[model samples]
Target: MPAITPEQRVLDNLRDTLQAYVAGDVAATAVVTVFRGQAPALALPEAFQRVLDELLRRLEMADVFSQDSCSFSSTGIQEQLGVWLDKAEARVSARTA
Candidate 1:
């Protein structure tokens, strides 16, 4: 077997962190949905954007937020920012796991 790369190690950690939720050889679709629902509508920093995009990509959704996307929201702006903070923390946990 080939040695694991750093990126693979990171993904392994992510899979492991959410592994409990993926019982009986399942994917984490429901969990991803929960996380995405909590993610906010904001113009993410590049690093944050990539994490959110990957989270969405894994979740099979297309709701990546950028400046253009952020512009479309009209209400509850502060709530959105708060959710982004939650998402950022979630992103950290997902990676560091």
Candidate 2:
């Protein structure tokens, strides 16, 4: 089996962090920190970064409201994060391949 790349590791961590945040085991800031801290390691495209930033922004707003206010559903954001993960993994794999 091919060894996991650093980008893959970062992506996995982000997914796990998002899950933990939804579970209330982690703070919203911590989740944002994980994304910001590890983003460089992923070497993501600018498009991905922009999308992530938008998601993080929505996440912060969601946290502030602490409910499905302003149409910012934490659950919806989490689902978006999952989709982001899928696309990021594909992008990373394509690059490596």
Top candidate (lDDT): 2
Task: Evaluate residue 23 in candidate 1 and report its C-alpha lDDT on the 0 to 100 scale.
Answer: 42
Tens-digit lDDT string for candidate 1 (1-97): 8676454454444444344343424334544554454333332357766665564453333223431254433123323433544665566556646
> For candidate 1, which ten residues in a row score worst on lDDT?
72-81
TM-score of each: 0.29, 0.90
Per-residue lDDT value at 25 in model 1: 44
How many residue pairs clash (N, CA or C atoms closer than 3 angstroms) in each of the candidate models, in the order given? 0, 0
Candidate 2 on 1-97: residue-level lDDT in tens?
Answer: 9898888888889889988988989998898899888876888889999999999899889889975776799889888988988898898899999
Clash list (residue pairs), candidate 1: none
